[model samples]
Target: MYLVLIAWIYVAFMMAIAEATSPVGSLLGAAFTFLLYGLLPMSVVGYIMGTPARRRAIKAKEAAEREQALAANGIQNAGGDDASVAPNAHGEASGHTIAPERKQP
Candidate 1:
């Protein structure tokens, strides 16, 4: 029980740090870390699992942003409508629907 409590506290701290460093919804890494650590009794296993999980979460977030950008730029389909695509305050595509330019302007 004590170990579990300690693990929970550790997870909370890690998650708080993650949340503070990244943008919105970036604390998923900490949540995943906490979950995995809480589920497993071995600290070694928790560390191994948590590391990759955090990395995967970050990669997934980046990929999502990239996709949104592509959609916004019109390089990719925005699910068939402008409304479906995320738009900026000015109603321009949020760049998720459009592809990024490879060349410098």
Candidate 2:
């Protein structure tokens, strides 16, 4: 991949040189040619090709952070095997209830 990029850069450089030397071509055209054909495409391709590496790096970093946090909290393992607690249940209505209305005098 990098070899291809290097080859393209070299080709673009030679083309730029040709443009600079040609009577009808200007230095600006050569600069644009190198930038558009060489640097720009290579950068885009490199970034695209590096996506999987970047994702793996991010996942690894997150896993490390999670492990560190769990270790700091003195947790030996993440999730499962813990005892579940049930809320205390009394067979009683808990809240205040309004008084029953009587017929007014």
Candidate 3:
């Protein structure tokens, strides 16, 4: 990824040099080449190519934060396997439902 950027910079430098030595108008050509070839294309391509990496990083961070929060709440981060987790709620594990303790007439 970074190699591409470096190669692009080298290309831009060479283009600018070529433009600066051109016969028509060196200054305008160099500026145009630097902006059009160097800054614009590289930035757009870099962003497009780096989107997946950025998204993965964001997902990893979010997952870590969610796991941290779940751990803080006494819940295990068992990779979303709910069956492996047991809550402290009454009768939750024994399949017994919680209801009122009223006497049956």
lDDT of 1 by residue, 1-105 (tens): 346557776776776577657776456665665556554445565576578779999998987887788767676654754353433547676548867889978
Residue-wise C-alpha lDDT for candidate 3, range 8-91, written one tens digit per residue? 978997989888987865888898898899989999999999999999999999878877877897877565753546555455
- Candidate 2, residue 35: lDDT: 95
The model with the greatest TM-score is: 3
Report residue 55 deviation for candidate 2 (angstroms): 0.7
lDDT of each: 0.65, 0.81, 0.82
Of the two candidates 2 and 3, the one with more favorable lDDT, higher being better, is: 3
Q: After superposition, how far is residue 29 of candidate 3 from its true place, in Å?
A: 2.0
Q: After superposition, how far is residue 51 of candidate 3 from its true place, in Å?
A: 1.2
1 or 2: which has the higher TM-score?
2
TM-score of each: 0.30, 0.69, 0.70
Per-residue lDDT tens digits of candidate 2, residues 11-84?
A: 99999999989999999999999999889998999899889999999998987886687678665553533332
- In angstroms, the error of model 3 at 86 is 5.1
TM-score preference between candidates 1 and 3, better one: 3
The residue pairs in collision within model 3 are none
Order of the predicted models by TM-score, top scorer first: 3, 2, 1
Candidate 3 regions exceeding 4 Å error are 78-105
Q: Which stretches of candidate 2 lie over 4 Å from their true place?
A: 78-105
On lDDT, who's better, 1 or 2?
2
